[model samples]
Target: MSFRDEVEDGRGDLRKPFLHTGSWYRMGSRQSSIMGSSQVIRDSSISVLACVLIVALGPIQFGFTSGYSSPTQSALSKDLDLTVSQFSLFGSLSNVGAMVGAIASGQIAEYIGRKGSLMIAAIPNIIGWLAISFARDFSFLYMGRLLEGFGVGIISYTVPVYIAEIAPQNLRGGLGSANQLSVTIGIMLAYLLGLFCSWRVLAVLGILPCLILIPGLFFIPESPRWLAKMGMMDDFEASLQVLRGFDTDITLEVNEIKRSVASTSRRTTIRFADLKVRRYWLPLMIGIGLLVLQQLAGTNGVIFYSTTIFESAGISSSNAATVGVGAIQVFATAVSTWLVDRTGRRILLIVSSFGMALSLLVVAIAFFLKGFVAEDSSLYGIFGILSVVGVVCMIVSFSLGMGPIPWLIMSEILPPKIKGLAGSVATLANWFSSWLITMTAPLLLAWSSGGTFSLYTVVCIFTVAFVAIWVPETKGKTLEEIQHSFR
Candidate 1:
């Protein structure tokens, strides 16, 4: 007998969604959400990789928007003759657009299916980039940034959920992690290109991924789990076979999917109120909590203010330190992708949380000492080195787990019935926390850099406990198995 046989009794628990939760949430309400999956013959791994890569482009676009202003800040400001206050608003409008996008993403993805949603998201991004490329005024830049941010917001939720739904259990962790990897790559590439290209040329380049993604969507299979949820059994099976390889036996997988679907209550509409159940609420809390902790770890505060921190620590070239931190984040996140499947999710999260706490404490101490010592004291040199080390260590710890794992786990554990709603809420919380941290970072640093990092240290320590106690290992589990563990 398979694991399903032994766990048959628990199917009753899964059925709660269909009987109650689905009713309130309008589950499976849209049949025409997306076109039918295309017939294709290919290895399962190739199909999965191809799909992930295509979807991953959205994140690259997201990163480009994020990194664009940093390198071109002076040039753009000078060319546009904008005030610091105006430029500040221009910088921040993206978060506003993202929050709006987060709230709408669930409804959009659910109504149109993941592929259709990506198509919708692409339109605005292309238009947004064009607006930026052709802009002659500050308002144009503002509108363009807002549009791109909104598009990225939608893509953020869809890509991970799409990847989670399509990836085979064995490859899920690594592939899911690719979303973060792509974002980092985009940021790095943007920074590198900004060195040579004019800001307008760079803005035009932002259109590249969306251009590729629009056509690329046609080649990949629609998510099989999505097909199964929509009650299209034939298409569901066909999609699964394409993902698993044309010649592979899908009988065992099909039975498991059938059992998984059967376990859910399929007789009702979806409802937001359905979240009162332990099954749904538990995973929702975990996803949102991790996102909260990820932000409160003060990663953004450090990123936003790293140059200043280095300057305070007595470094002559703060920009070099900032760039070094970015490189560390990209490298650490890259290593994480390889280790996620091999080492498992829970362990990495725990290690990451505690490691960050420890690193922040070092910086906190360094900053605390900066005030009392004489400027030319020997300790000043030591403290400067400590700050750099602390900041880099924090970046390494974060990139290893907290940075990517929250997004990966968020994509994995939520049931399809509540994925859009729950995912949107979680994504919103993440951006909210990011905005909060970035906005307040300078304030906190001015008040007391030590105090700010100390607060972050406390949060990271709490995260270590939270993950160790609540986060389950999700390395090799299917999406169904992951949701099951939440109970």
Candidate 2:
């Protein structure tokens, strides 16, 4: 009569089914009765807040790296006596570090708990920030950037997994949005700090969250799913008790865990060869393709080089232009917090791609006509407006699809056994694509600004086409349900 019994009885369609568990329902019950009906809501609420705070900390590091580097790239270039090519190398190398870190962190997380993995990630972040604050030469600065990139990669891969594992099925989308929200807020904070103070001061401030939050992490509980995977049944039940918040049948929960774990354990060890199977390969392709599409839309190019883009478009104050672009990014992501669950992934991606293509086309036209408008104030005004539109479009587009969903989808798509490896591969793809785009932006700018924007516009068109054909609808699907789709 329990939920697990019903599943075993084949009483309902397993395909596209939503299991009511955790704090939401009791087993053998047709109605969605609250588990431990009195206190379940209270405990789940507290647990979610804790997860949000911890996950949000990881994103501040990402925001610091993504936002701080751009406005100060020119300053660092001047101070370090470096050429444009060196700056590009700096960006690419950071991505290289990120690529390594993401892969390593997955195994670490699997060995330790998600909370412990995140705490470990925070160490390099704090060190990176401290090093950047006092970096005296290009080499030291490059080292700091690499360290920061490594920390970001770890945090990015681990935090979403933690959130997904801990969050209740009904609230997953909203909680997942917190991760993106934090990143946007972090970016906004970094830009504001960079605007008002020296880059060193901004870098120094970046270390504060790591210092303040490290102690708080100890009080948090390990993920129930992770505990189950480790065969820590007592700890898993205890963790679930805290998470679920009510007196409920532990039997159903334990059985569900056993079913999932059994399924995973029967699978072969994840070799690169595992990805050759269609069941594994399809999700991996989706993950990598999403990252590639994100970069090809030139989101990072516009964000990291917004000042240069604005200057080329005739903006006078590079600092002011970059700040404006940063503000647009924050606002657009904030809007996405509301839009993502409501609008669904595919719609947002399609809309964003078209919007980006249109904005880039306008920017390309402005760049192509630069000679004719050299002295025209009206043309400058028009160009500035279009640049702002482009930035807004990029932010909105990215937040809705590329910014948050890639990680969210990747976390859910793979089976638990391969989750760590698959997540690492997907994240590596993300960093590599980021490196490719960031490293190429400056060269592309120097070669032909109009041509670069046009190229991105073309890429966006192809991305839209691909999304329509290949990406499955993951909206409202449970982690297990998502994986089942591929099979």
Candidate 3:
């Protein structure tokens, strides 16, 4: 049977499928107060942008968690009397917590709604930071890090998905890229603040993003697509109207969303066995492949151990250099935000992977040459400087595409019916790979700095090939439209 035929399901008059509820009326009254007609008439983009910015804070918190270890590693290790292995475990435990969180994130978002899930995520992050700040022992510190990672894992999946769902097709790429942009800002803030603040103070500062996010979430509408899928038809239409602008005619768009949802068995639980279907497995493969490759490229390793990397490169002010790298990353991601819609996802990803490969190769070569020269020799110092340059270039390359695009693509390509289960699996794979890379980076670097980066370079090279072969271009497509392309 045709998809449309199956979805119609004897429901006559498709145009009248939705019926208003008392709850939608209540929501409308509140919406009227917040979204005065005068404001909506001007341009609807502002509302969507505001919502994206608010949720973007979650990723800022995510970035702060990722960046926290870099600046505070030395101070925290000394204060807690942690060994190299213990500190590495400390750095990687967030990934462990994130893996657990990733496993549950999809179901939580699916059950509670995206806005509610984010609210749940914020509480743990705030508590996690507080625990880290007041901790007098390693146990508290470890617990706090785990809690923070748990929050980050949820934020990682929900923010991009939320942004993609709300944004207009023309704006989706840029808005989605904002997730990574905010994350870079968070990382930058952590690095910058770490320079001036003690480790405890930095931990305390990490609480601010969630503090802002918790209140901000109440102001935005729940995702319209999620509402539609759950049979909250009236609320879904109202939410979409508010996002698109009260003055905008939303009939065609509303119908499109209805058809998309109706085509699926909305209440049917997707089994692991169902994933064997071409439609289900194809997007799943693309989503999972991108996410796993994103981590295997060793981003967290560079981020978690950036200070140490700079010190090894012979930089006297390694902390300051780490901050500079953070700044550069934020700038690169910002450029990517502007370019994603215009240049397209596949092109940017291919270029990003190649640039990362080249940059890591440079670092590998610099480290290899450094080992052959005397420590005090001119060539040794030059190679050290070269390694620093390579790391910066690698970060810039990564931020431009690999950092943002995978999450964007994952959110875009997956069909709404199976997104929750499949997204969790993909997110779990990402965190697992991250944990492996983060846990082993210190040991790998100590064993052979050149070899560690050489391995990453090889991964980056493979990423280029994977994107060229398997990944699709998702630029300027609606979520429903993108899903159809996979078929």
lDDT of 1: 0.80
Q: Please tell me which predicted candidate would have the highest TM-score against the true structure.
A: 3
Q: Given candidate 1, what's the lDDT at residue 69?
A: 71
Question: Against the true structure, whose lDDT is highest?
Answer: 3
Assess every candidate by TM-score: 0.88, 0.86, 0.92
Candidate 3, position 436, lDDT = 90
| lDDT of candidate model 2 versus the reference | 0.72
What tens digits encode model 2's per-residue C-alpha lDDT throughout 396-468?
A: 6667666776677667676687777777888888888888888888889889988898999999889889888
Once fitted onto the true fold, the runs of candidate 1 whose alpha carbons sit more than 4 angstroms away are 1-42, 263-269
Question: 56, model 3: CA deviation in Å?
Answer: 0.7
State each model's C-alpha RMSD to the native: 7.8, 7.2, 4.7
Q: For candidate 1, what is the TM-score?
A: 0.88
Q: Write the per-residue lDDT of candidate 3 for residues 167-218, one digit (tens) a residue.
A: 9999999999999999999999988998889999999989999999988877
What would the TM-score be for candidate 2 when compared with the true structure?
A: 0.86
Candidate 3: RMSD over Cα atoms?
4.7
